[model samples]
Target: MKLPLHERIRSEIETAILSGTLRPGARLPTEHELMQRYDCSRMTVNKALSALAVAGLVDRNKRAGSSVAQPKVHSMVLDIPDLEQEVVRRGQRYRFQLSGREVKQPDPDYPEELQLAGNSDLLRLEGVHFADDRPLACERRLISLAAVPDIAAQMFDKISPGAWLLEHVPWTEAETRIAAVAADRTIAARLELPIGSACLSIERRTWRGADGITLVHQHFVGTAYDLVARFGPAKGSTGAEPQQL
Candidate 1:
C-alpha cells in the first residue's frame, strides 16, 4: 500500500538520519529545496519536518532551519520485562543470587559494543536467577560508572541489577538481541544444565542520551521457558495489525 505523500517524505529523511547518511548536526534541505526536489507543495514538506521535530529526530528553528538532532535514547518496549514477575506468572517461586561484583577500568581488549574508552571505569556484576530452586538463567552485566555514578555502592545482592537500574537510572534508549547456543562448561555449571544443552541467549544494551549505561548478557535454559512479545497499532491510526512473537 502506498503511504501519503507527506509520510513518504518523512520516512525518507528519517531513514537518512538513522542510517548515518545525515549525521547529528547535519543541516536538512530547506523547505523550498525539498518542495522542489519532491515536486510537492510547501505544506507537505512542512508537515514532514514538523513530524520529525516532534519525534525528537530533528531540530527546527527559523534561524538555523532544520538539522539532525543529537541521538535521543531509543527504547524497545520488549527489553524491560521483570524476570521475577515472569517466573511468578508461570506459578514458580523466583530467586536471585549475586555471585560476584567489582569495579574496574575498561580493558583495551573490550568489545566495541560497550562504546567505552579503555580508561573508563565499569561496575561488573555476575549472578544467577532461579525458579523453584532450579536454575533458570545466568546473568553477567557491566554498568558504566560515568552514566550511573553510584552504581558500585548499590547492594545488587539484595535487589537485582535490572531492578536497581530501572529504579535509579533514567535510560533513554535500549537494544536487545536474542540468539541460541549450546551451553559451554561455564554456563552449563551456572545454570545447572548438561554440557552442550541448548540455551537461549539475550544481549541487551541501554543508554541515557548518548552515554552508554549498561550491557547485560542473559542465558536462559531453553526448554523451560520462552520469550514473547506482542505489538499492535495505536488507536485511530491505520497502522500495522496486531502481531506476536
Candidate 2:
C-alpha cells in the first residue's frame, strides 16, 4: 500500500535520521524547502514535522526551526539467560531442535534497521527451544557472514546460535525491541500455541563497533514466561534517578 503524501515525507526524513545521514542536532530543511521538494503544501510539511516532533525524533522551535534530537541512551540490563540453563533451574528437562539452517543473501525484504550492505551472504537459522519436551520459544536469526566468517561452518545441532555468538563474538553494543504480537500459523506450530495466540516477540541486534554482527527475533509463549529487567542504583552511588527515554 502507498503511504499518504505526508507519511511518505515523514518516512523519508525518519530513514535519513536513523541511517545517520542526519546526525543529532542537524537542522532539517526549511518548511518552504520541504514543501517544494515534496511538491506539497506548507500544511502538509508542518504535519510531517509535527509528527516527527511527537515521536521525539526532532526538536522544533518557532524561531530556530527544526533539528534532529540527540538520541537518548538508556542502560537496561536484561537477564538473557541460556534457555537450557533456565529450564534446568526450573527442574524441567531442556531440549532444542535446529529445524533449518542455510547460507543465503539477504533479500530485499530484509529490515533496513540492520544497515547491511548489499550483496553479502547471511546465515539464517530457525529452531525451537523446549522445556520438558514442551515448546517454549521459536527462534529465527540472521548472522552476517561478513562479520563472522567462521559462523558458516559451525553445525548448530548441539548449540544455539545465540549461545555460540555470545561465546565466540565480542560485541560492542546491542539494541532490543520488544512487543506483543499474535502468533501466525508458522509461529503457532513451532511454539505449539493456537493460531492468533498472544506471544512476546523480541528483536535484538548486536553490533561490533560500527559493523553489524547479528539480528535475531525470538517469540515466546506469553503464558509460559515473563520478561523481567531490574533497575536500581549501584553500591555507594549518589545520583539522581536515571532519566526516562
Candidate 3:
C-alpha cells in the first residue's frame, strides 16, 4: 500500500537520520525548499517535520529553520549466537542484568514499526547484556506467554531468553535486521553511556513451526561489538574461510 504523503516524507527523513547523513544541529532547508524537494504541498512538509519533531530528530524555530538532529549512537545487532558466544569465549564473560519485566496491554500509541499488532498480553523483559562486567547491550524483549507458557516461571537473570529458548524450544524460522541509532536519555542512563552515543539495534522475530510467532527480541548493543555473517560452499568444495573484519 502506498504510504500517505506525510508518512513517506517522514520515512525519507528517518532514513537520512539513521544513515548519518543528517547530523545534529545541521539546519534543514526552509519549508519552501522541502516542498520543492519532495514535490509535495506545504501541509505535507509540515506534517513530515512535525513527525520528526515528535521523534526528537530536529528542532524547528521561526528563524532558525530545521537542523540535523544529533545522531544517537546506540549499537545495532542480530541474533547470531556464534558471534555472541565468540565475544565471551575470548576471555570476556557475558552477563545480563534484569532491569525490568512485566505483562501489559499493548499501547495504542505504539509505533507500527514494532509490527506487534493485536497482542494485548505480552511478557516484557528489559535488561542490559554485559561483557567482562561492562555494559555491552541493552535489550527489551516481548514474549508471548500463550506461545511460551513456561516463560512466566523461568529464571532470566542468568540465561537470556534467546539462549534459553534455543535450548528448550526448537525454533523453525526467524528474521532479523540491524540498525544504528543514537542513544536517547532513557537508554543512555541504563547502558551508563553518554547521551547521543552510537549503538547498534537488533529486531528479531522467532517462530516455532506453524504454531505462529513465539517471541520478539530487541537488542541495543554497544559500539564495540560487530555483527558478522559467514557463508560457504559444500563441505567437499575448496574455499578459504571467511575473513573477520
lDDT of 1 by residue, 1-245 (tens): 35689978987887787556888899999999999999999999999998778767889999889999975442224446677767776777777899989887776676743474224688888999888888888999988886676676778666788878866565546678889999999999998888999988889888644668889999988887676665433111112111111
The local lDDT score (0 to 100) that residue 44 gets in candidate 1 is 96
Give a tens-digit lDDT track for model 2, residues 110-156: 56423643347888889998777888888988888876777878887
Q: Which candidate has the highest lDDT of all?
A: 1
Top candidate, metric TM-score:
1
lDDT of 3 at 173: 43
**lDDT (C-alpha, whole model) for all candidates:** 0.76, 0.75, 0.64
- Choose 1 or 2, whichever is better by TM-score: 1
Q: Which segments of model 2 are wrong by more than 4 Å?
A: 1-79, 111-114, 117-119, 232-245
Report model 2's TM-score to 2 decimal places. Answer: 0.61
- Lowest summed lDDT across 10 adjacent residues in model 1 is found at 234-243
lDDT (10s digit) by residue, model 3, range 1-245: 35678877876776676445766677788999989988999999999898777666778888888886653432332233632455466667777788788876656576431344234366788887777677777777776665566777876867877677656554434567678888889878877888988877777777543333344444454456655554433111112111222
Give candidate 3 regions above 4 Å deviation.
1-79, 82-84, 108-120, 212-222, 232-245
Off by over 4 Å in 1: 1-76, 111-114, 117-119, 234-245
Candidate 2's clash total is: 0
